[model samples]
Target: MTKLLLGRYLPGDSWVHRLDPRTKLMASFYYIGIIFLANNWQSYLLMFVATMVMVALSKIKLGFFLRGVRPMIWLILFTVALQIFFTKGGTVYWSWGWLAITQYGLTNGAFIFMRFVLIIFVSTLLTLTTQPLSLADAVESLLKPLRRIGVPVTELALVLQIALRFVPTLMDQTTKIMNAQRARGVDFGSGNLFQQMKAVVPLLIPLFVDSFGIAEDLATAMDARGYQGGDGRTKFRILQYHQPDIVAGLAMVLLTVGLVFLRA
Candidate 1:
């Protein structure tokens, strides 16, 4: 099973990894917007190609993106199946009683699945390239404008940083708990769906308790360090955009335009 990856940064010297964190963050948001605009297979295909280019630039294998998707594969498959079953339009390819699969449904399901894949790949690329600390800095910088409106940007960034930092830890905790349960003859993967869900309650209870315990420990550690708000705090590494960052921004702009044009 693929565990969740929150801020799993893979260090590299490639151009994608070298861009300023803010650039990557903004580009990610823009990419998400463009993805929602895609209404055709051609647009989604182009977007997937764009994502692959980023993967190549970041010096990561395509399998890296696919690996994290194992856990979600069931969800994706279910979603696509639901879309195929529910959507009613166009020619009916297969009919059984009141349940009919139409050409439109197949098209919609395929497009939605592609959209999901592209978004997942792009977001994973962003986190894989940018470190958690850098992401915090970028989020703080981006949210600075909201500070004047009484937004607690620093606190929000801190929450985000902590959440990202603990994703792997929580995943590890879940794995250990599951393993222990399985050893004791807990059938998490067998039986009917309801029975499987009942088995998960035991897992969730302990996981939540441990999560809270970890959160309390984190708070205590931060308090022990005399941590305060980011009023006058300075970063050890400063972010500065380079030529490659600008080029990447321009490329994103072009990609967005192309997706818009390609939308059916």
Candidate 2:
């Protein structure tokens, strides 16, 4: 269960792992921008090549990336079907009673599907290399300026960190509950849409109850520690922007500019 939502965090001393979390976060944004900027096959090919290069640098196994993508298979298929059957403009490929499959639809569907896949894979690469703690720290640091506006940066960071940490735990709990239901002669897979929805109720109830219980326990623990929300907290390790981070950021800027120019 922990294995389900936590994704594959492959431990390696690769260049991606050594990159600053801020750099990776910004790069992810730039990468997504480029993905959306893509118009034709040429831009898509360039984006794919760039994504592949990032994956290669991450040094995570291809299996890990595929595993991350498995959950989105249904979504990709749904988008493809939606685009192919609904989009209109180009030559008609086929037509049914009230549905039309046009050449434009096919092209649009393929492009959207590939775009989604590339976005998912590239984002997964960022998470695979960057530690959760590091991500939280980077986010907190990035949002520090918001403190001037009376925003609680530390509390926000803490919430994000706890959410990330518990994601795997909650997934494990859900899997356990699902298996327990299955063992009790409950067929979750083999059912109509309504039946499947009904079957999930039992699973969801237990999951929600357990989640509340865990939240309560966490609150109590925090209370026992005299925890105050971001009053005057001091970090054990402060984040420093290194030269590599600056270089990476500049590269991302260039990538964004290049992609924008290509689109133009």
Candidate 3:
């Protein structure tokens, strides 16, 4: 759980880190489109290559990104297992009454897993490169046009900001609670499934209590700092698009085109 890196930011001087948050945000959507557009092995390979290029541009270690993927490993496997056993049709490989495996099942299962992996990889890159505050601002800027229709973007942005901000805090608290429980001889990973769940219950209570306390503190601090919502707000560090952002944006476009061609 501690290896989970959603909404966490790491500071770096890489061009990916320095690009306009809006451009990065836009590119992320296109990248996600590529993930869905991947219909064959060739398309998947192309997407993988493009992602590696982006990772190189970010200047973050491949291992660092892989480490953050640890938490989702079980989920990916479970999903694959589901598809492999339940999906019907195509050549049957094995069978046991209601339980069966087929070539179709295996192929679809692998595709789903690869799709999830690609999504996670790109998302990890986004959070690792973009700071939380910058992400919030980028979101606000992107949704600014929606204000013409009265979307209440400020409240939405605040919610997103708080959600992103608490991910690391919750992760830290989870680690601490686990450590404290371990010290008390609570065997979290021992015994049956129910027993493991029982051990986790003790950890959750304290974590929730601490989380609420921290949220209260944050609200109080914001109130003390005169946070009167996002109306008429001014930015200290304004966002600006540069040549690198344009070049990166163009690269994303070309990558998307290549992925589409590969899929076709």
What are the lDDT scores of the predictions, listed in order? 0.86, 0.84, 0.86
Tell me the spans in candidate 3 whose CA falls farther than 4 Å from its real position: 1-7, 155-229
Cand. 3 Cα-lDDT? 0.86
Candidate 1 per-residue lDDT over residues 229-250, each given as its tens digit: 7677776767788998899999
How should the candidates be ordered by TM-score, best one leading?
Answer: 2, 1, 3
Alpha carbon deviation, residue 47, candidate 1 (Å): 1.3
Candidate 3 local lDDT, 1-264, one digit each (tens): 544444367789998999999998889987897688888889888888888888999999888788767889999999999999999999999999998999889988999998888788898899899987888889888998998898999789888878877887888889899999899988988899999999999899999899889989999999999999878877676789999988988888788788778885
Cα lDDT of model 2 by residue, 23-82, tens digit: 888789778876888877777777777788788988888787787789899999998999
C-alpha-based local distance difference test score of model 1: 0.86
Per-prediction backbone clash count = 0, 0, 0
Model 2 misplacement above 4 A: 162-228
Best by lDDT: 3
Q: State every prediction's TM-score relative to the real structure.
A: 0.73, 0.75, 0.71
Q: How accurate is candidate 2 locally (lDDT)?
A: 0.84
- 10 residues in a row with least lDDT, candidate 3: 1-10
Best by TM-score: 2
Superior candidate under lDDT, 1 versus 3: 3
